[model samples]
Target: MEEIFDDPTNEHRKQELGGKDPSPPELLKKIEQLKVELVQKEEKLLEIDLLYEHVSRLTDKIRTAAESGRHNTLLLAKRTNELQKKIKDRTQKMMALTAELSMRQALAIKLQQEMRDKEHFLMVVSSRMDQGLPLPQETESEWLKILRNEKIRSEAAEARARHAAEEAAATAAGGVCSAAQRRPAVYIPDSDYSLPLPRPYGALAPFKPPEPSSHMRHYRKPIIKPTEI
Candidate 1:
């Protein structure tokens, strides 16, 4: 009994039993109660350990999720910066292209105007030449020489026709009608009239003189003078 009380493990039991040795039946029942209480205390300790493990796992998961969220946010910010830079570069390129296009368009318009001016100059030159007008500060070109020769030829032809007509009139007034004058007269054809000469794209027809009519022909009649006085 002294040994039992001296042990620290039985001290609380000794106090509860009033420092007396318990009867066999009471000891048995007390031993059974102590065993049940020990089991209950061990079960409570096991439940506390399980709850701590669950809380530790949840804390680790929350920490990992926070780190991942921060990393993703950084990545999104970096991508946004890169996209903004690319957009700025693309916008500058577009502006350059637009300026180049405008310059090209202006150049094209200027070229077109120059072409129109050249065409107008050519038209004026062609029209002047066709009208037989004199050129500015006339140089002695081949075309000019040809034109002068044609004018001279035309004047000569007109003078010859006038002379022939005068001669026929003088002959008729002197009262001489010839058999040649009585012949059938050929009339001038409409196609023989003078017209503006065409450019030298084709063969140029030679100038033709007008034909004399048979009515213009006259014979000299012999006059009988009085017997030699």
Candidate 2:
């Protein structure tokens, strides 16, 4: 039985050996071709490395360009800011000058108004004089008399006013005088209150108070009461 199994195995081995194709020379040729392909592949890898180096240099140039562009942009922004500041400053100065000009214009207008008022007053006076109206009693002689009277009256008035004002000032400044001491015994006449009356023909007559009516005039006739008789 062993010989029978061994016989089939030997026969199968013989058939496999007979059917197998010889491949040693083909494998050697394939190995030599693979070595050539590997050499070409190594050359391609070297070319790829050089391309990578060129790409790196190009990337660095791009980075430099980007940085330069950023710097230029920053410089432009700074210049814009400075220009804006200058414009703002100029605008403020213009506003200040405009305000000053407005103030000056207002002052000029006020002065013009004052001048117009003065001119109007003068014109009114001249027109009244031209209309043959009686002028105010301020003639040279009358004025001289008025001035002399005013000088005397003013001297007296100033003395009284000064005394009163000084007393008031002293009281207000914490003077030691009592109330009774503060007031002095003095008598003033009603006649002393008289002011110079203007003539009826004078220009200032229109401004004076109306004279008393005839019915309102005072008389010295005595009243006869029964008890007095």
Candidate 3:
């Protein structure tokens, strides 16, 4: 057991001595590797700082562009509203004008139709006049002819009545007297009527008067005496 313990102690001392004793070239190489690793780490930290700054600048530019777009959009909306109002006003005015035109056209058509009706009526009247139609009256032409014949017969009756009246007046007067008082009554004959008896002139002669006085004989014309002057 004493020999085993002495062997372990010796082995431990040898390892310690070996670990403490290092080569100069090996230490120098290890220090150079450590410096290279430190430099690489510093370079990676700088790249990260630069990337963060680039991202911040891009975000600022995007925010500014969005603000400007909003302003432009508001202006476009205002202009579109104004244009819509103008379009509506013009459309209403056009509709009113169209309605007025339609009314005028209707009135013109009505007047034209009335004129056409009047012209047609005139044409029909003229055509009827050209057909030799008689004027309207209470009696027709044949009835008028009958009335005219009755009027002519009435005229003849009036003439006969007048003749009868004249004959009555003559009969109411004194009878016609003859020159001779002793002669028989004689009637003169008319060519168109029956004759009565005729009397001789001697039987119809009046009686002679006595001689006139000297004053009455002086008023009468003297008889011419055929003597030698």
Question: Highest TM-score, which number?
Answer: 2
Which window of 10 residues has the lowest lDDT sum in candidate 3? 176-185
lDDT of 2 by residue, 54-155 (tens): 999999999999999999999999999999999999999999999999999999999999999979867876887899876465545676998999999989
- Local accuracy of candidate 1 as per-residue lDDT tens digits, 1-229: 6777778876464544357777999999999999999999999999999999999999999999999999999999999999999999999999999999999999999999999997986787788899998654433475688899999999999998986787799797894644343332333334556445443423444445559767766856589988986
Q: Best lDDT goes to which candidate?
A: 1
Of candidates 3 and 2, the better by lDDT: 2
Tell me the number of clashing residue pairs for each predicted model. Answer: 0, 0, 0
How do all the candidates rank in terms of lDDT, highest first? 1, 2, 3
- lDDT tens per residue, model 3, 1-229: 5675568656643433334645888888888888898898889888988988998899899899989989998999999999999999999999999999999999999999999997986676577679876533533566799999999999999998987776677667965433343443454555566556464455655555756767875585889988996
- Clashes by residue pair, model 1: none
What C-alpha lDDT values do all the predictions have? 0.80, 0.79, 0.77
RMSD of each: 28.3, 18.1, 42.9
Residue pairs that clash (backbone atoms under 3 angstroms), model 3 = none
Models 1 onward score TM values of 0.37, 0.42, 0.39
